[model samples]
Target: GGSIKHDISVPVSRMADFIAQASEAVTARLPGIRPVPFGHIGDGNIHFNLSQPVGMDKSEFLALWGEMNAIVHGIVRGMGGSISAEHGVGQLKRDEIAATKSPVEMAMMRALKQALDPKGILNPGKVV
Candidate 1:
């Protein structure tokens, strides 16, 4: 629990500025937090994770997963970044995909899913 990982997307135009502001916000809230901010700059997708403050217990730090997600994801989403980024909508982020993806897009996706897996057995109860 001593580390956290947040994969998020930002608009290409706001990538640099968004990361800067987000990192600053994290540092301000949790001094000494090790920000391991890295990822696909071309796609404006950044994995902004943080290691525990030096010498802090990893388990205790990891307990802040939801809080860390809130902070980082909040900032990233505010800048129009996808919280799921490159990770396809497995069970973990299905609802998030639904929330972010458009209706027409979702419909098209459903059609593709049905076409590929007519039995609906593939990845059942996952994406669609």
Candidate 2:
């Protein structure tokens, strides 16, 4: 059995709606996978995890990581929630953030990175 983990944060008021939408989206796209969502609802952050179905191939299930991220993160984004909650973006979410962020925002981030770490010495190729 393998597991996929994702974290998202939405407004406290919309926590219930976000959870419903997210669950529906995941189940609709991946009927066989069982989503085990849990976290601090007080702040509206959810640590959504998925477990591979019975008799499912580990590699095959793990291969859905990116696809699941897209499905789940899309729902989170549409609900005005952050794709990365608590955990800062790393290589795992670099492309997702780039795709989700605006061009101007991306440019500003790059500028800041370049200005602060001209040689890309700090955490090279991690974020931005």
Candidate 3:
């Protein structure tokens, strides 16, 4: 009934693998799940969209949003890719973005954030 959209990017070398692996992963999780991978190939950005299977209840299909995100994002991470390739990381992925970063990377990111917003006024706590 509705779709879950992923704005992800991987290295050019891994584009094909990303698509294949993600598609296979989701299909295994929910048979009949349609994996729509399309976008700027040159930039390694694939707007991975998932359409619910036919005859399924809309709410039932939508309930798998988080699980599907985990499935696809895991592949993206394994490929050394960005989960947010185009649109900024919104509420759906804000926590995930931070959780996936290494401690060192998180520390560096916090240092930079501190430098940029000493008072924590700008989009306070919106990013890692």
Candidate 4:
């Protein structure tokens, strides 16, 4: 009854391929894990939720969150999609975003953060 969810967005044209490939990737790596994907298809965003397999330990299944994120987010990135679309990067996805973002993009983001919130007081340890 437990599940881990990820928010991802691909271009409208690549939505179908993204879904198929993502599902295959997850299922391949984690057999028996149920991938229940849903969300704003019109806008090309998907809330990909992986349900724990029958009789699986909730904590153990949930522990694979990062691994599943990588599988799904990799497909999204391959399709030129964003791992955190609409939902800005927060603490939950900070490390993943850092890992996925390019050096120049991260630099620009850090620069903006410094320029706007030099004190690191507003939402500290987030976004940047």
After superposition, the stretches of candidate 2 with alpha carbons farther than 4 Å from their true spots are 103-122
lDDT of 3 by residue, 47-126 (tens): 99999998988899999999999999999999999898777555677788886778887678678878988998977765
Number of residue pairs clashing in candidate 2, backbone atoms closer than 3 angstroms, sequence gap of 3 or more or interchain: 0
lDDT of every predicted structure (CA atoms):
0.78, 0.84, 0.88, 0.86
Quality of model 4 by C-alpha lDDT: 0.86
lDDT of 4 by residue, 11-59 (tens): 9899889878888988898889898888998999888889998999999
Model 3 lDDT, residue 14, Cα: 98
Using Cα atoms with residue i matched to residue i, what is each candidate's TM-score against the true structure? Answer: 0.77, 0.80, 0.82, 0.81
Give the alpha carbon lDDT tens digit for every residue of 64-117 in model 2. 998988888888888788888887577888888977778997788788888988
Residues 1-128, candidate 1: write the lDDT tens digits.
Answer: 36687777888999888878878877887788888878888978888788889977888777777777778777876877777777645776667667677899788878888898899898897664
Better of 1 and 4 by TM-score: 4
Report residue 90 deviation for candidate 3 (angstroms).
1.7
CA shift at 77, candidate 1, in angstroms?
1.7
After TM-score superposition, what is the CA distance of residue 91 in candidate 1 from its true location, in Å?
Answer: 3.1
Clashes of 3: 0
Candidate 4 stretches with Cα past 4 Å from truth are 107-122
